[model samples]
Target: MTDYVAKALEVDIDDAVRRVREISEQEAMNQAISVVGAGPAPGGAEWEAEQGTDTPAARQTAWQLVRLRIELATGIDPFGTVLGLRRMGTTWATIAAAAGVSRQAAHDRWGKQVLGVLDAYGTGELGGPVADDEADLRRGMAR
Candidate 1:
């Protein structure tokens, strides 16, 4: 679970718990992304037909797979950041600021939900290609 983000933000598991529970500004990020406006858009835009006649429906189908891939892969990012920040000692107030809501609202959206993901990660329940060191994924993010 240790990564650049975790290291730089000091969001290892212990820190996540501490940061998430308190409102202290020891080292929290000033802004946070709201779940409502923060999600990645489902994409099927660049899919090229690999077989058959490249019809609109065929194109649609090709892109459907892309959308599915994106959804399955990066769905954890928003909360992962929250979990990391929270674990790192970032305050809920900081998180809520980014979410544009009260601290409780951010907690309600991501608190318990993050726990489930944290559990999965803690037990290695989920496995796949996790980004290791590359940065700047704005190209893939929602517009």
Candidate 2:
């Protein structure tokens, strides 16, 4: 396929995936809101009748869902960005500087795993092996 066509297809797929994520996150937020909005805590008689067994689980799940929604909504995929930067030859020291951590600390914390992901993604554009133009694009984006 032509490069333009391939790029368009990739963009379409990315958009579809993003939409699915948004919908799932919205549903999760709605569920969490419902759980939190449920009326006041049960009194002795009501508590005995209703059984508190599900309350803790529900609240925990709801909160967890809410956290996930926040993460997704924030557009902060540390893993992806870190791996991408590493693949683009951003040294650990540079990354650490940007992140406000020591170089050794950055390597110790993320070097192996992030590099591994970067290797898997092949340091490229369109989520494939890195190419010269892709590197140029990354540099452009950085600027």
Candidate 3:
């Protein structure tokens, strides 16, 4: 992708993450509504019962949604460090140090590949617009 496109993707990802967070917050509000509608309780029992059932499911769903948001925002598949490095730019070196690898090694492994694929896919030079470039890359690499 061009730098502009990459930057745009970053913006889009940020928006998507914000939207997901909003949805999660809404979900929490929905749970609260349910609890409120369920009526007054005698000594925390009803609240505890609701908590036992709703909290776990809500928490799990929220976490999963956040994970998806992270994936979309970063454009990096799980275990692929490229998106993080690209997003960090010069700070990638510091990230590398924290990850216990030399900066160059980290860059070599993760830096250009995602952007290269983005460029290829964005320009329609690699077949066509991909539904998901990361998934396409993974499939292409597997073949």
Leading candidate by lDDT = 2
- Give the higher-TM-score candidate: 1 or 3: 1
TM-score of 1: 0.29
Give the per-residue lDDT digits (tens) of candidate 2, residues 4-84: 977776665777888876776566556646756643466766556556477644454445434433434565344444555
Per-model TM against the reference: 0.29, 0.32, 0.26
The better-scoring model by lDDT among 1 and 2 is: 2
User: Model 1, 1-143: lDDT tens per residue?
Assistant: 65887676764587666665343222121211221122223353433332334454333333332332232243423554565544444455556665567766766677657546645657733233232211222222323
What does the lDDT come to for candidate 1?
A: 0.43
Best-matching candidate per TM-score: 2
lDDT of each: 0.43, 0.53, 0.47
Poorly placed runs, candidate 2 (over 4 Å): 1-77, 119-143
Give the clashing residue pairs of candidate 3, or none.
Answer: 1-119
Model 3 gets an lDDT of 0.47
What order do candidates take by lDDT, descending?
2, 3, 1
